[model samples]
Target: MSSSAGTSTQGEPLNATALNRQLKVMQDRINQLEAQLQAGSGAPRAKAGEGTPKERKRVKLSAPREFDGQQAALAGFLIQMQAYLHFYEDQFASEFEKVTYAGTRLVDKALTWFEPILKDYYENGDQATDFTKKVLNSYADFTEALSRVFGEKDEARRAQERLTHLRQTKMHFAATSTTTG
Candidate 1:
C-alpha cells in the first residue's frame, strides 16, 4: 500500500533501508527459532510413557558396604562392588581407579588381604608387573584374587550335592514318562 510496505515487483529494486528492515525481520525470526530450539519448546513433546527418547539418568548408588571376608557376604559384596564400578564406569577411567575404589571398600580380613597388594603397588608405582602390582592394577585380577582367598570353602561338596539332586530329579522325570513302543 505504502512505499515502506513489502517488496516491490516488476523489476523494482528495494532501497537500503527496506533491505535492512527485511534483514532485521529475518534475523529476528531466526533468533526466535534459535531460542525455541534452545528452550526445547519447538519440537512436539511426547506424553508420559511415550517413546520420546531421553538421556539415561545416572543414578547415585550408595557405596557398597565394607567387606570383612565373611564367606556369605563375599558374593553379595563383590556384586555390589561390580554394580558400583559398572554404574560409575565413567568416573573410573582406568583399571587403577576401579581396583583402588574396590580396595577401599574392604575392611577387617578383606582389608588385610588387600593391604599387601596395595603396599606393593604403591611401592612399585605402576601396576603392570606380573606380581602383586598386577593384581592391584587389574579389576579382573583383583576380583579373582578375592574369590580365591574367600570363595566357598565347601564348593566341591556343594557342587556334588547339586549333581546328586539333579540326578534324582532326572530319574523321577524319566520314570513318569511312559514310553509308547
Candidate 2:
C-alpha cells in the first residue's frame, strides 16, 4: 500500500500542525460543554457578593456574639455580624441562608422577636409578611429592619430632648443646708 497523507473530511490533508490545532479545539469544546452541563444540573450557585465555596478563605473566624433586643447594642451587633459574614461569606449560598443565620445568632428577646419573622418567611414562602419578604430577598433589608426595631434612634432622640432642656437650677444664697447665723 502507498503511504497516504492525512486527509481531512474536505479531502484536504492535515499536516501535524493543523491536526494538533483541530484536536486542541475539540478538547476545548468538550471542556466548555462539560462546564455548562455541571452548571445547569441544579447545582447551588453562590450569591453575587459571595464567591464560590471552594474559593473561600479558610481563616480562623470569631463569629458574632448573640444579640439581645437592646437598642444600644444594635450597632455593635451589626458590625460584628458584617465582619463575621465577610470572613465566611461562601458558607451561605443564598440570601435566605444569611438571614436565617443572623436569626440564629439572636438570643432572649431578640430571638423571640425573630421567631415570628422566621416563621412567616418559612411557612409563607415568597408571600411572607412585607418585612419578612424583604429580608428573605436581601440581607441588607433584613439588617435594616432589624435596626429599625432594635436601633438607638428613639433613645438618641430622647437624650437629645433632655439635653435641649438642660439648665442650671436657680438657688437662693440664704437657703443653706448648714446652720448659719
Candidate 1: segments with Cα more than 4 A from true spot: 1-19, 22-57, 126-129, 164-181
Task: Write down the TM-score for model 1.
Answer: 0.64
Q: Write the per-residue lDDT of candidate 1 for residues 1-181, one digit (tens) a residue.
A: 1244555554467777877877788799889988887899865555655663343334579999999998889899999999989877878989988999998999999999989777776676764357687676689989988998998868999899988887343434334767899
RMSD of each: 6.7, 13.6
Evaluated at residue 122, the lDDT of candidate 2 is 74
Residue 36 shift from truth in candidate 2, angstroms: 39
Clashing pairs in 2: none
Model 2 weakest 10-residue run by lDDT: 1-10
